[model samples]
Target: MFISDAMAQAAGAAGGENVLMQFLPFILIIAVFYFLMIRPQQKRVKEHKNMVAALRRGDNVITSGGIVAKVSKVIDDNEIELEIASGVKVKVIKSTISTVVGKPAPANDTADKK
Candidate 1:
């Protein structure tokens, strides 16, 4: 008669709701990471895909290798001919290009010389 009722004590203890509350912070942390890290990364990948798809001849671009060049020819879907210097050219894969420099404004200086 003096024995403790183990089954009654176990049934009365905090259960599923208490366990879920303990993990609530961990769930929130994962949600924050997805929005702040994963989402932006995916968006940038999409924008880069669009930029690469829109490549055309005469676009002044910088490559991932840090070389700046102008697109001399669109060889095919996979390769391009870049003109790095006058009469000097190199064949590079299309994806090797990184960023396109914005077109320069028209020069105000005239060709007339004294």
Candidate 2:
């Protein structure tokens, strides 16, 4: 007398949504993150790698530690010699160079202007 057969039939009729519909919001959130965050970060990393690869002797640079110097020599793939003052040089890791300050005067252009 307490349990009704009509109530049991109604409960069975109400089913949940499909599995894909339940996970659609999560998938959209991940896509948003990739476009807004991860993609741009990867691009910046590529640009920094290209800039570091283009390093050459005589280019003025600033290190990550805020020291200003000129690239006196590129020691190897991962190291460089910086000339901070006249006859004062220090060896630093290439990645420690934060920015290329000013490029050296091009020899051919200077000679032509003279």
Q: Which numbered prediction scores highest in TM-score against the true structure?
A: 2
lDDT digits (tens) for residues 1-114 of candidate 1: 334687678768978999999999999999999999999999988888788777887889999999999888898988999999999999998888889885444555665452
Which 10-residue window in model 2 sums to the lowest lDDT? 11-20
Poorest 10 consecutive residues by lDDT, candidate 1: 105-114
Evaluate residue 111 in candidate 1 and report its C-alpha lDDT on the 0 to 100 scale.
Answer: 53
* Model 1 stretches astray by more than 4 angstroms: 1-12, 103-114
On residues 15-59, what C-alpha lDDT tens digit does candidate 2 reach at each position?
566667888999999999999999999998888888888999999
* Candidate topping lDDT: 2
Clashing pairs in 2: none
